[model samples]
Target: MPARSSSRLSPANSRIESMTVAACGGLATPAIETAIRIRLPASSASNTRFIKRSFEAVEPPLTLDEPGRMLMGMIVRPLRVYVSPVFRRIGLMLLAAVVTLASPALPAGGQDAPATPEVAVTDRVAPVWDGTYRRIRVPILMYHYVSPLPENADEYRRELTISPDTFRAHLEYLFFEGFTPISLYDLDEALLTGRELPAKPVVLTFDDGYIDHYTHVFPLLKQYGFTGTFFIITGRVDARDPNYVSWEQVGEMAAAGMDMEPHTKNHVSLQGRDYDFLVYEMLGSIESIKAHTGRQPHLFSYPVGQYDADTLAVARTLPIWRAVTTANGRYHTTDNRLEMPRVRITGGMSAPALASVLRGD
Candidate 1:
């Protein structure tokens, strides 16, 4: 294509530009014109004097094939009009007009794409920094397979596979020590809304929807009256994978107060993938989980605890309120929701060792 003449009004940052949208849905030319017409101060003198030069230059009839065709040049090139001050805020207005004009004329979806509503520019929402609240010490304990590894399993399997007895010990120690196990959803709600958390709030998360979660993890959670978070590869559930949880078991666990979350449709690192694949992995998984469980999960666990900026952006674009990665630490309100960290529990870590990690030592 002709290098897609591109621009955008960073209404949030006070910048603007426009372009010929690629094939599909986008901000159409008329919509851009309308946004500019509405935002410009509606004085006739201002429109006649300042806004005319920029708008006349970009009003579509002579879309030059050359990319980056400067607006000043476009006006002067054909009509040979001397560019003069069009308004008091000519500089910012011109930049905005240019960016909006250069922005792809449709949403990437197609002409059928819904036009984005034009709203007054506003300041961006400042991030919730770590010091925004008294930071809570909530350790998100991450686990995978709870079954004992087969004899002579490799180191990766060995580290990921903690025995059922060890799992029980970890829960038992937590139960005795007055650690209240909360679901990821509960922690997320408290962290985001400043709600009260349990006295010793900690999260127990299982990845890959392994059957051990139903067999080994769920019963322990019920025994201790603890709520846990389970991240399932939606595609793997009820697939007769032999080691994964069935939809019926997953529903049962959710009924028992476990936070059921998407681990993506298939278990894979969702880094460096295209937008479609990201949509498939992120939105598709959410839909699949909702179809099975009837409730939409608010949290997602990055498959294998892996993600990138693109993946995080996609997670936020959807209904998922937050996401988790493999980085280990106690979560604070200021933590990045999508790239939030977790403390991994592996084979051979006794109850005392886990307590040390949880105590923020």
Candidate 2:
């Protein structure tokens, strides 16, 4: 077989040839002539000038006896004369054909077609509760404050509150959209068995044991039939500060199915603390939760999600099954439960944006 010519063909030219061939009933010669005439530049500067003039002249057409061949010859003669041999040998006719056929398929504005919608295709394909290896994991998200005020606000005056309307919209979206709020126990079981979570399984979590968690957020969660995890600062439980939730409020939330996990005795960063100090902070809070509510928490959320290898080591030594971290990224089964990642919800998170995050977008 003869080696194919290595001339590059433009999409535009290929389309033109296709259209010409279709119009001329699959005959190659006339299509080739039409392609060459359309693609090749006019011969000489004078010929170029004349061709431009001819188009502008707008004269009546002359009838020719040998219309087909004569018209083809007239159209292609200047192209053969003008185009350089290098371009001709490279099959400019092929290039022209591609262009013509492709032009009409393009939008009138010469833009590409709108992009196709993407379907989320995953390798894992099993029901979340099936206890199979192919199941996907659901992430439990946590939030502390959703204040519109800047972080630089005076520590005393800053509010840890999101507006009622925004909170309501968030709750409404979760309910209407069928997001099943699960417990930490459910999450652990899924991880252990490789079970898929519900299609829209998301756990809502709040930290700091804020009074607002009871007064403002709790009613909303209750109204929406959703459950959340609340990690309290053990030392601040009944402090005089109006911000901290009282023991009574914490008890109510726990009774209502919210997990009141430990966030350390003091809200101190435990990363660089000594072993003794770390143990006290970790164990003291766990004991406090048991003493106050009669429920020992197995989960511990790091204060500010700030912990080092030493802190992590201490966490592992303790009876805690999971230690939530401030790291960003969607969770997977292979992720370390002790250093489990949680998406931080804030005032800036819109419904669509939150949906995207929940969907692991």
The C-alpha RMSD in Å for every predicted model, in order, reads 15.3, 30.2
RMSD score of candidate 2 (Å): 30.2
Identify the candidate with maximal lDDT: 1
Candidate 1 lDDT by residue in tens digits, 1-361: 0122222211222211221121011122222221212132343234322222122222233232243256634432322222222221233333333433343333223344332333232222322323344456688889888887788889988888888888889989988888888766666666655668778877888888888889888998788788888888766652346678876787788767677877876678887774445654665566545544656567888877777765665565566666788887775553456667889888778888887878773
lDDT (10s digit) by residue, model 2, range 1-361: 1122332323222211212321211111111222332343443233322211111111122112354445445444544444433343233333322222222221223344332222222121222333343324566777766434556766533433455566777778888898898877667667756545676787777888877788788888888878888888876662324678876688788778788888886678987765445655676576556544656577898898888766776665555766787777556453365777777675546678678777763
Q: Over 4 Å off in model 2, which ranges?
A: 1-135, 146-161
After TM-score superposition, the amount by which residue 170's alpha carbon in candidate 2 deviates from its true location, in angstroms, is 1.0
Question: What are the lDDT scores of the predictions, listed in order?
Answer: 0.59, 0.57
Backbone clashes counted, model 2: 20
